[model samples]
Each structure stands twice: as C-alpha cells, then as structure tokens.
Target: MNRVDTAVHVEGLRKRYGDTIAVDGIGFDIDPGQVFCLLGPNGAGKTTTIECLEGYRRPDAGSIRVLGLDPLADHGELRRRIGVQLQEASLPARLKVWEILKLFSVLYEREKVPWSLLDHLGLEEKRDAYFDKLSGGQKQRLFVALALINEPEVVFLDEITTGLDPRARHAIWDLIRGIKEGGATVVLSTHFMEEAEALADRVAILRAGKIVANDTPEALMRSIQRDDEVRVHVEGSLDAAAIEAIEGVATASIDGDQLIARGVGRGWIARLVNGIEAQDASLLDLSTRRASLEDVYLALTGEDEYSPESPATEEAGT
Candidate 1:
C-alpha cells in the first residue's frame, strides 16, 4: 500500500507463535481522520494485528508505517504521535486517577490538559478516586482519557467498551465521533456489529489470521445476497400460506396474530401490505428489517460464535 496520504499503512503483515499463526499476511491502509475498524471474533487475530502496528509485538514479516514512521524503527517518535488503549491494561491499585493521567501526560512531548480529558470522558468525579475504587465503566473511561492525553494524530482502541452498560457504550461512541471530528484517525477493534455500523467509516473483517472482507458497512451489506423481512401484527389472523403466495415474498409464517414474511427487498413491503389488505386483515403494527453488518460478517467469515451481547475477548497474544 502507498504510505503517502495515509495515517497507517501495512503490507504482507504476518505473525506467529511457534506453530500457531496469529496473523497471516494481511494488509490494509487507514486514511487520515477516518474511523477504520478491525472486526472479528475472539482468536481471529485482531489483537495481534493491532499490536504489530502499535510496536508492542514484532511481526515475522511485512512492513508498517504510522504517520510516515516505522513503528519499530522510529519507536520514540511514533509513540508520541499515536495513542493506544489495549484490550487489557492495568495501573497501580493505589494510584489515583488524576495521578495516573498526569504521569502519562508528561511521558509525551505534547499532552492535552489532564483534567480537561477527564471532563471530556466523564471521569472528573473519579479524578481523586483510586484506580482500584472506580467502577468498571469509570475505569474504562479513564483509560480512554489516557489514550487521548497525547493529542495523538492516530488513536488505536482495542475492545474499549468490552464490559460497559448501554449508556457507557454510547458515551464512548460519542467520544469516537468527537475524535474523528478533531481530525484524528481512529483504528477501533471490536466484535460488536452494531458498534462498527454506528462508528466505522470503513471496516475490515478478519478470520483465522486473514482478512475475509473489507468495505464500508453499507457497501458490505449490499454485497451480500440476503432476504429482507417484514413483521406485521394484525387484529385478524393472516394465513401463512396466503402471505407466502404473495408475488414478492419468499416465505411467510404466522404466530398468534403476527405475520412474519421474508422477501426480496424493500419494494416487497408495499406489496405485502396490499396483499394483507386484500386478505381483510387489519395491520396494527409493522416493521421491516434489512441486512446489517452482522449479516455481512457471518456471510463472509462463516462464523456464528460471536454475538452482539457476548463479552469481548482478545487473541492469545493479548
């Protein structure tokens, strides 16, 4: 990949542990100020790939460039220009949050105001609290603040919202959007399909040490051949056989007063409604479901072990 005009560039990247290959010759480039996501299931080599870019682990083969500098060769300069939040990290149990932030700030040539970062991540109240005393969500937010303390040109977040509640998850999503708006490139690694769909400008899906697919979420979803579904709750019973006989519907089933139909595309929605009306059924409520990132991931990787609600885990390398 061309290194010019890119925030991160990798080519023929490969890593291994004894006989087990963690990364197998993968390559992808991230543009400046774009939210690029590395998405895959646990043990899919997400952590290994990101760490190679962060200079934490050396790849057996391939080349990497972040901000126009080699991660391993120019470690000092690259460290100052890029921020990282690992999948797993730790701080001294006795260290107060403010102290942690202050300590990390001085390690870089340029740093953002520690307290301001705390406020931005909603960790100001925990600033005086010890690292061991903060809640899981609070601690995660503090780690995010630490990653941003350097005002990095590129930020790497690996499973940053792994165990947080819905509110906390959305807060971090907003922060990611803010990071992009501030002209910083973000490389986020996660298995959550909704999260990637919500935040990623482009997504690269990995599986078994290789990239299976890469594209915008919309484009990727469009690439797959899947049926759209429409569910309608009716006051009167709708015959499954009659609905299935509709010109555009592929299949239809009825449960209680609800009619569920899988069809070709959005255009079938209107046809189904008209068909239902002709059958003398009152449509009380209706909703349509379209192809999503999860669909694309499953179709490309053929992995169903990962779910949206499952806890996130990194590969063996950490």
Candidate 2:
C-alpha cells in the first residue's frame, strides 16, 4: 500500500438533522502522523465532524477522505486502518479487561501483545477487573488500550480526558503524546482549551457548525485582539491616550488608580515603560500577562468555559 502525505481531508462538509444543522461547510486537513485537535463547546459539531471522518456517519454534503479513501464507500478498509475512542465509551459490565483487548486485537490483521497493550496504557493491574469495577480513569485507560489493540494507522479520540480529575487528565495527556511519538496520525476532539493547546499540532475551532478559527494554538491566541496585558499601577493619573500613543500598545484603560495597558506586540512592554517614565509617573506596581487559548475560545464562542449548563453532546449523524 502507498503511504499518503495527508492523513485526512475534508472539503465543503455539511450535515444536518432536519432543521438543525450539525456541521456546515467545514473544511480542513490533517497531516500524516500529526496530532490534529478539534476544539469547540458542546454541540459545536466537533464530534459530528469527527464521526464523518471516522466513517461512522456519512456527510449530507461535501467530501471526506481518511487515509486517502472515502470514509463511507471504503469503510471496510478504512475501519481496519483507524481506531476510535468515542466520547461516552463503556464496555460490558461483566467483561474483564484482558478479554476485551484480546477480542479487539484479533479484529485487525496487525496485532499487539495483549499484555504489552495493558502495560502501555497502565492497565496491567486491572487485567482481572471487570469493566464496571474500574474507576473512571481506569475505564478510560482501558478504552485507549482497546482503541490501539488493532495497531491502527490513524486514531480518533473524542474527549479522551473529559470527567477525569487533574492527575488522571495529565496522565492521559502523556499517553496521547506517546501515541503521536509512535507514528499514528491522531484526530482529537475536545472542549478543553488546555488539552487542545497541549496536544494539537494544528487546531480548528468550530462554532455553530462551522470552523471559525484554524491555526496553531499559539497563533490562535495571538490572533485575538488585546491579548497582551500589562498592568501599571500609577501613583498619579495618566491619560489613557498617552499610554495608547506608545508603540505596540493597542489600548489603554483606567481601573481605579491602575493603568491597564493592552499591548499589540512583543515590544509593548518596553514602550509602555518608557512612556510612563517620561511622563514622570511613579509606578506603584507592574505586572504583565499574555493571553492563552482559553481567551480565544471565550472570545470566539461567547460561552463560559466552566458553564454548568452545557448539554450532553448528542451527535446527529451515525
């Protein structure tokens, strides 16, 4: 078989369930062996889009190719080459861990030693544990093992770390990094800003069934206006325009006695400092903070990251 440079490609993709559009004219590509992250709020069509590429659902419009093959038409070949971890995954309550891994390993011609998969995902200790007996983190680890049991060329991970505690989430992150290092192209879909920032070689931020932003995490954060913030606590009043006049300063504001200066470039800090000193303003305090992916997500979606009202994501297409 010939190896392709692009692991997955989507063009003008569209899907709808009746009047509610699930995905709308979205397009992006994933490079071979790259970790591509799909980031969005719940119901932002992240999973729906991923499912199309995974061959679980056919798009209502547009085209998708995974491993250079049509996901639906070539699903048999595609399924053998791709492994998936769905968002709300669970196994039979009575099934033991090793039994499931052993079962999945045979489904594909390529195989990984069941024990090695157990050790690789830190599930060696749970070999005898029933699926229902494992904790949330343990269950997730087992799922990852099952996903990789086939030694697939491409892996689709949907919300891999959702509901995991901080410690477990970090552990899962390490496992995902290891997956990339092993030469498999990974498509990750998640609402967690930090997960995307930490794992994605490239990210496409989906909003209302369409891609609103697509870039590296750093570039996405940088694209947001007013991202660089430097707070200068002035002993006396300083005109907002005077601070804004400094090169690299995008905007200036007053918060009580503090001058809140937002910078546009790397040199914003130096310019602000020079301008303040020249104005004979004594600095009571000074601190600088840069923007992050979370800021970009909030600005793009107009939704709180920690909002409790987020609906359980229900995908429309298969």
Clashes of each: 0, 0
Model 2, 120-232: lDDT tens digits are 88888889988889887888788777788767889998887777777887888998899899999999888778889999999999988999899999899878875577888
Please list all clashing residue pairs in model 2, or write none if there are none. none
Question: Model 1, stretches more than 4 Å misplaced?
Answer: 1-4, 86-90, 236-246, 254-256, 312-317
Q: Highest lDDT among the candidates is held by which one?
A: 1
Clashing pairs in 1: none
Considering summed lDDT, which 10 consecutive residues are worst modelled in model 1?
A: 309-318
TM-score of each: 0.90, 0.84
Cα RMSDs, all models: 2.9, 3.6
Residue by residue across 1-318, what tens digits does model 1's lDDT show? 233598999999999999999999999999899999998887889888989999998999999999888999999878888888833345888999888888887776444545788888888788799888987678778877888888889999988877777788899999999999999999998878988999999999999899999899899999999899888999876778888888889999899988889999556889899989988888999998889999888888776666657753433224
